[model samples]
Target chain A: GAGVSQTPSNKVTEKGKYVELRCDPISGHTALYWYRQSLGQGPEFLIYFQGTGAADDSGLPNDRFFAVRPEGSVSTLKIQRTERGDSAVYLCASSNRPYNEQFFGPGTRLTVL
Target chain B: AQRVTQPEKLLSVFKGAPVELKCNYSYSGSPELFWYVQYSRQRLQLLLRHISRESIKGFTADLNKGETSFHLKKPFAQEEDSAMYYCALYGSGGYQKVTFGTGTKLQVIP
Candidate 1:
């Protein structure tokens, strides 16, 4: 089976710009998660979706970050007015259950200039 | 607040030697501990979980509540084991968020 996939492997944009990153989870995975990894650091949890609604979003750093998983299989992470500090690799993962092993994507690296 | 700590940023070991990657965590309640590994050019993947108590790829970890630690260990090191390892903690009680450590890079010298 195909693993998780993310669009636009790399994206470079100026500060204060808006960007949207997309993630396509494995087929039939009900639990989806988003994370961000900066240089020399491990991935930081952002949000999680179970089915069509976000089950937990406490990891989101600020209001500028938002995500939606309307249909449940696909998710989009939106960052408004991106700052240079927001530059990092955004990762997406999915699993059969909430606490089950998660399958991760290759990640989309966002660079803010 | 829940947190994970991997003190070593990098660990180098020779093949066939014993290996141990330290991981310590802090959380108010019982937490599910996990070890995630990322090989070069590969996405991060689950190495093992403390609850399972099963060894994967010759690796195992034990959660010690008294010490608040969950360290990954293996009897013999393999060159293929070289990669980045991350220790994570999930607080099932509330928020359901997983906290990750800074990660340690393992270098296996042949």
Candidate 2:
């Protein structure tokens, strides 16, 4: 079975640039989540989508970060005016249900210079 | 506020030695706890969950409600067990968001 996958295993960009990270969740998964993991730190929750609508976005650090899953299958996390502080691995996960075990992707490492 | 804590950031042990990784969580409601592991060049995966109460790969964790702890233990460590481990919590709150603790890197020396 195909698992969750993220595009651009590595992305390097200059500060103030815009970038988009894409995630393809497993087929039939209804729940998707985004997380950011800094060096030597655990993954921090960013946002969650139960379907087409975002069920939780409180973990989003600021307005510059936005994510959308319009089709409830593919998701994209967009960052505006990237900053050095945003350099980290952006992880994506999906599950069949809200409480089901999440399957994680390899994650896209975003490096802001 | 709900939080998961893995106090140890690094743990090293010799093969065949007993191992224990401590984890404590704080949540107002009954939280579902889990241990996730990531091997070298591998994506994070579930090692075990408290609700299942079953051991996986010679690892077991006992959730203690009174102490608010779920410590992972194995009678004898193996070199293949080396990996990064994270403790996570899923509260009953809206969205059922999962919070992970700073991971612990375990090194098993053969």
lDDT digits (tens) for residues B1-110 of candidate 1: 89899999999999999999999998998789999999999999999998899999999999999999899999999999999999998768646798899999999999
lDDT of 2 at A55: 91
Docking class of 1: high
In terms of lDDT, the best-performing candidate is: 2
Instruction: Pull out the clashing pairs in model 2.
Output: none
Residue-wise C-alpha lDDT for candidate 2, range A25-94, written one tens digit per residue: 9999999999999999998999999999899898999999999999999999999999999999999999
Report residue B100 deviation for candidate 2 (angstroms). Answer: 0.5
Q: Give the CA lDDT, 0 to 100, for residue B18 in model 1.
A: 94
Q: Give lDDT tens digits, candidate 1, residues A49-110.
A: 98999888999999999999999899999999999999999999999987789999999999
Computed on alpha carbons, the lDDT of every model, listed in order, comes to 0.94, 0.95
Candidate 2 wrongly placed segments (more than 4 Å)? none
**TM-score, per-candidate, Cα-based:** 0.98, 0.98
What tens-digit string does per-residue lDDT give for candidate 2 at B7-100? 9999999999999999999999988999999999999999999999999999999999999999999999999999999999986768567899
Q: After superposition, how far is residue A78 of candidate 2 from its true place, in Å?
A: 0.7
Proportion of native contacts kept per candidate: 0.70, 0.66
